[model samples]
Target: MIQRIQSLYLTLTGIIGIICGLITDFIPNERIDMILLLVVAILAFISIFCFKNRSAQKNINYLNIIINLLLIGFMVYYLLITPGGDLSPKKGVELIVPVLLIILLAMANKYINKDEKLIKSVDRFR
Candidate 1:
């Protein structure tokens, strides 16, 4: 489980999600964004232990990706509505967190798929 590359990716995704939650104050809607970030983190962590079920793990990663995309959309909407227009320093490290999460989750999913294909090929010899 822990030795898998997808597990490592998921772990990083969880950590990033936690960091995003901690830095949520910079975003316009702190409460909602923080809750979402924490949820994503929890889901990522939970999925790590479900390595026995690659399909379930992949589904969880897909869910996380969707949530992160939603987060990015929320961040963009909030950033655009802020007073100082594009001139303000509203964009912060928090804005990049979701994108990073998505990338990590995608990589994890890729590895998961590769593992699944490999398993399928091996099982065919039985």
Candidate 2:
């Protein structure tokens, strides 16, 4: 499974998600954000082991992507409601992590689709 590029992408996504959860403190009531990030990380890790089931892996990635989009929306809402006239560096970092998660998830999905197509083509020869 590690041989596949999607596996590597999923691993990175999981790691980043964990790191973001641990270090993120810019938002009020950060527990919710942290929990969501951890959930995303767990999903990514689970998807990694489902390499034999491309459809399942793709579905998990889709779920992760949707969660990340929600996370991004929450971060944006928080940023807008913040009292400070200027945004803090940590706020920027917090927002960027979810976007990064979405990108990595999308890349993994792309590669998973490619692998599915390859398998289909090979099956056609039999």
Candidate 3:
């Protein structure tokens, strides 16, 4: 039930994000918003790879957690700090895809939990 709910949420997020991204040109003022949607869409896409139950999935999950953390760290740095240049929308533009990628990785983690072998690896979101 939770999986279905999450899946549906992700599907909606993905669709809206994609649509927003496609119309980015028309909505120049919405670059940041569009980018966020794009990220959600990307996450949803990666979340489709879930598995089912496995005790050995810890290492994989741990690895994913690390990567997700790193990605988030980078995102924070990129979004919050500017080296010396103007702190403007243009500067943050570079972070769009990376943020999207991070969200995708998180979604992938969720997806990995679907493997029967990895089912045991997951406690919640069942």
Superior by lDDT: candidate 2 or candidate 3: 2
Q: Per-residue lDDT of 1-126 in model 1, one digit per residue for the tens? A: 779999999999899888868874555678878888998999999999999999999999999999988988888887777776565565655677788889999999999999999999999999
RMSD of each: 2.1, 1.9, 8.4
Query: Which of candidates 1 and 3 is the stronger one according to lDDT?
Result: 1
Q: What is the TM-score of each candidate against the true structure?
A: 0.90, 0.91, 0.34
Which window of ten consecutive residues has the lowest lDDT sum in model 2?
Answer: 84-93
Off by over 4 Å in 1: 85-93
Model 3 Cα lDDT, one tens digit per residue, 48-121: 33323222333443443454355445546655664545534454454454355445445544554554434555
Clashes per model (N, Cα, C within 3 A) = 0, 0, 14
Ranking by TM-score: 2, 1, 3
Top of the candidates by TM-score:
2
Q: For candidate 3, give the lDDT of residue 20.
A: 55
Tell me the deviation in Å of residue 70 in model 1. 0.9
